[model samples]
Target: MDSLFLVLPLLLSASFPHFTSAHNTAPPPCHFQAIFNFGDSNSDTGGLSAAFGQAAPPNGETFFHRPVGRYCDGRLVVDFIAKSLGLPYLSAFLDALGSNFSHGANFATAGSTIRPQNTTLHQSGFSPISLNVQWYEFNDFQRRSKIIRERGGVFRDLLPKEDAFSRGLYTFDIGQNDLTSGYFLNMTPGEVKAYIPDVISQFIAVIKDLYNHGARSFWIHNTGPAGCLPYVLTKVPVTAGQIDKYGCASPFNEVARHFNVKLKSAVAKLRRSLPKAALTYVDIYSIKLNLFQNATRHGFEHPLRACCGHGGKYNWNKDHGCGSTVTVKGRQVVVGKSCKDPSKAVVWDGVHFTEAANKFIFDRIVNGDYSDPPVPLRFACYRH
Candidate 1:
C-alpha cells in the first residue's frame, strides 16, 4: 500500500530557551551557516518524490499550493527549523533540476529506514535510499560540491561554502520505518525489538562517519509514537488490549519507546566517543504523545484520524488514500482529497502531520524543553 510510504516532518522552532555554561555565562547562539539533514519523510523535503515522482495533488495545497516534494499539506518541521535560523528551505540532494544547494541539502526520502531493506520499492513500498545510502550521498556531495564551486560560475552560487560543512547543523529523524517494516513482514513486536540494537549500531556508525567528515553539531530525533498514527492503527491488526486509553496501539508505542531509549543511550555513547561533536537528543515521542493525550487542549480535533483520505473509521484506506486517483467510469477522478480545513486536524494523511500540528510540535521543542541537556536549538553547537 502506498499509504504505507509514510513521512513525518520533524521540525523545531519558536520560544527560544536560555542556557548557561559551566562558568555561569550564557553561551552565545550558534551561527549555523548551513544544515545537512538525513532521515526519512519526517524531514525530507523532496528526496523520494524527486527520485520516483511528485507526491501528486493536494499534498502541498495548504502552503505551496501544489505538490512540492513534501508529503504534508504545508511545511514540515525541518522547514520551520530553516526559517527560524534565517536560512532558506533545504533543497533535496537528489533534486537536480533548478535546485540550489547554497544553504543546505536534505537526504531524507519517504519510507526510509536505518537498515537497508531487501525488497523493491514497488514490491514493499520501502525506500531503497537507506540511512547509509543517504550518508554516502552526503559524503559525495560534500566533495563534489566543493570541486564544482572551484570551477566558478553558476555552480559557485548554487553550492554551499566549504566551511559550511563544519559550521552546519546536522539533523536526523529516522528509525520508525525499521520497526514498521518488520511488522509489515509479519514479525511480532518482540521479533522487531530484537534487531533494535543492530539498527542503533548502524545509526551510531553513520553519526561517527559524519563526525569524521567534519560534522560537529547534531540534532537527532528519536522516532515518534507509531501506534498513534492512522496508518498503523488501520493497516496493522491489533487486539483491544493493545490499544491504549488515548486510542493508540500500546504494543507499537512500546516498541517505539524502546527504540527511543536505545537511541538516547547511543547518543550518550557518541558524546563520549566523538567528544568534539555537539549532539542533542530530542524527545519527539513525548511531545507528540502529549499532543494526542490533550488534543482539545492543544486545539486539535481528531488527533488520531487523518485530515485527508477516504472511507474508514480513521478516514484512511490503503487503496484510496489522500490524492489517490480512481477510474470511475472510463474517466479517472480524484476521490481522495483534502478536507474542509487541514489546520484543525493533527494527522494530515495517514502518516504525516498537518502544518499546524508541525508548528505546534516545533514551538515546544525549539525551546529545549523536550531536548536533552535542555539546550535551545540555536545553541545546539555546544556539547553542554
Candidate 2:
C-alpha cells in the first residue's frame, strides 16, 4: 500500500543537492547573541500546549519522557540549533512555570499560518498565534522588557531589550500549514496556487517588521517536502504512477518543489531589498530528503512510517492518532500506540520527524550546506 509505513542513502548524492560537512563548526557568525524563533510545529518547543493546554502522551516520549506539547518525539530543529550555538534550549514564550527566556524566546505554535485568514484561498481560519499575531507579541515582549528594565527588576530573563534584539538571530520556520492546509480545507488547486503571492507578501512583511524592530540576522527555512509526509500521503489520493521509487507521492513532491522555488525567489527579492540584513534561507526539504536518500547512514530504518500512532499502514489512524482518544463503552480511552524504537524511525508521528532525524538535520544545517548564501552556523551565528 502506498500509505503503508509497515512496508518502508548513500554517497551524499550530488544529483540531489550539495551540502558540505565540516566536523568543526565556525565561531557563531557575526557575534549574534540570542535566538528568537517563530514558526509552527516544526520549530515549536512548547508553545502549542502552553497556549491551549492540550498536550498528550507519546509526544515527547523518546526524549523528554513526557508530553511537552512538541509535535515531535523529542527536541526540534531549533533545539539542535540552540545546542550547536552553545546556548540554552529556547523557552516557549507562553511557558511561564519554571522557564527563563534569557537566551531568547520561542514564539512558534503548532498549526500556525503566515496569513490569518486567506478566504480568497479558502483558508478555514488561523491559529491563535499566526505570523501577524506573533509579530504583535514580539512588540509586546519588547514593551514589557523595557518596563521591567526601568522598574529596576531583573527583566532581562523575559526577552531581549533594545540593543539585544539587534544582535539576535530571528528565525522564521513557517508556511508548511499554508501549503498543506488547503488540501484538508477543501480548497481547489487553482485557489491554492493563487494564494502563494499573499503568503509571500505576508512573510516579507514580517521580515521587514523585524528589521524595523532592530533585528539584524535572519534565519529563514523553506518548507519541507509535504508530499512525502505520512499524514498527507495517508489521506490524499495517490495513484500507482504517483508513487516514486522511495514510496513518496511524486505529484506531491513536485508541488512541494514548486513551493520551494517560489519561496527561494521570494527570499532573493528580500535579499535585494534588505541589503543590510545578514539573511540565510534554509533548504529544509533537501536535508530532510537526504535522510531518506541515505536512511541507513543516519541509523534510520523507516523513513515514511511513523514511530507512534494507531493502526494503519503508516501507523497513523486519523481517528486514533498520536494524541487522539476513543470512547470505549462509557469511558474515553487513549487509543494511540507507539513503536518501541522511535529513534530509528524518521517520523515520530505522522507529520513530524523523530528527534534523531532532527539531530541529523541540525548536523547538516550547522555545517552550512543546505542554506542559501551558505553562512555556516558554525562561525556565522553565535549565541548570547
Candidate 3:
C-alpha cells in the first residue's frame, strides 16, 4: 500500500510539471522595460525653457495646465512613445524643475540640430545644446548610472555583463528643424537638398557610436514632409495655384521623397554592417502621408491649417504666434485659438503636431504598422 501511494504521487508530479517552467512558457508582458529619447521640440518635454526659464504659451496647456516646454498643446512624440511602451512619460534630464531619470529621460533640446549648420533655429546668436552636446549628456548619464550602482554596492549584480547588451530601446527624431532652419536662413530647396546627404552621414555615425556604447535596439524616424508644415508654407514662396491632390506644396513633397530615399538606403546599409543590432526605421514619412491622405478619416478638418493662428490670407496670425497672449477685459487671454477638439486637428502649430496626431503615430509603432514589412522589429524579434 505504501509503494502504491508513492507511485501515484510520482505520476501526478510528472503530469503537472514544474511551476517555474509553466510560468516561463507563458508570454511575458509586452512592454518596453526602458526608453531613451533624443530629438528636438517634437519630443522635448521642458528641457530647454525649464533650464533657462524662457516662457512660451499655449504649450502643455492642454494636459499639464501650465507650460511644460513641449511646444505643443499636449504630449509630444516622445511622450506617446513611452506611453506605447507602457513606460511613464520621460522627463527631461536637464529640466531641473521636473527632472526624473528613473524610467528614462529626454536628452533633446529645442532648436538643436544633427549638423552644425542645422542650429540655425537659434538665429539670435546664442546656440542651444546641439545634438553633439546631447550625445555627451547621454554618455554622462551612463557614467552616472554606473557610479550610482557601484557606490550602492549593487553594481556587480545589477549590471551584469549581459546588462550592457540588454540595454533598453533608443529613439531619435530629428532633422526637420535642420531643414526648416535652413529654409528660414534663405537657403533654397535645391541648396538644402545638396546638403542633406552629409547631414545623413553624420546621423549614421551617431547611431554607430551609440551601438558601440552597447545600444542594441534603435528606432530612427525619417524626416516628415516638411514643405507641408505651416511654417514653410507661410515662409517659402510656393508657386501660386500649384498644390498636390492632398493640398501640400509639390516642391516640398519632392524634397521629402528625396531625403527618404537616401535615408532608407543608409539605414539598410547600417543594418548590414551591424548585423547584431536591431535597427528599425520608423516611417514618419509614410505615417505623415497616411495622416494627410486620410485627414477626414482622422477627423482633421484642415490638415494644412495651423490650429493656433489668426490671419485672413494665410490662415495664420502674423504678429502673434502660438502661445502669445493678450489682455482682454482685465484678464489675460491667449492670442491663438484652438479647435473645439485638438484631436480633430493635425497641425498643432506652424510646425508641430497635436496630441491626437502623436497618439496615431504611436499606434502605428506599437501595432507594427509603420515599417515597410508591416511588423515592428521588437515584436518580430520576440516571435523569432
* lDDT of every model, 2 decimals: 0.89, 0.76, 0.70
Best candidate (score: lDDT): 1
Ranking by lDDT: 1, 2, 3
| Per-residue accuracy of model 3 over 268-318 as CA lDDT, tens digit each | 898779866766777888888779779898777788888766654435654
Name the TM-score of candidate 2. Answer: 0.86
Best by TM-score: 1
**Which scores greater on TM-score, model 1 or model 3?**
1
lDDT tens string, model 1, 92-184? Answer: 999889998999899999989999999989998899999999999999999999999999999899999999999999999999999999989
- Pairs of residues clashing in candidate 3: 57-323, 310-317
**Candidate 1 runs further than 4 Å off:** 1-24
Lowest summed-lDDT stretch of 10 residues in model 1?
4-13
Q: Weakest 10 consecutive residues, lDDT, candidate 2?
A: 7-16
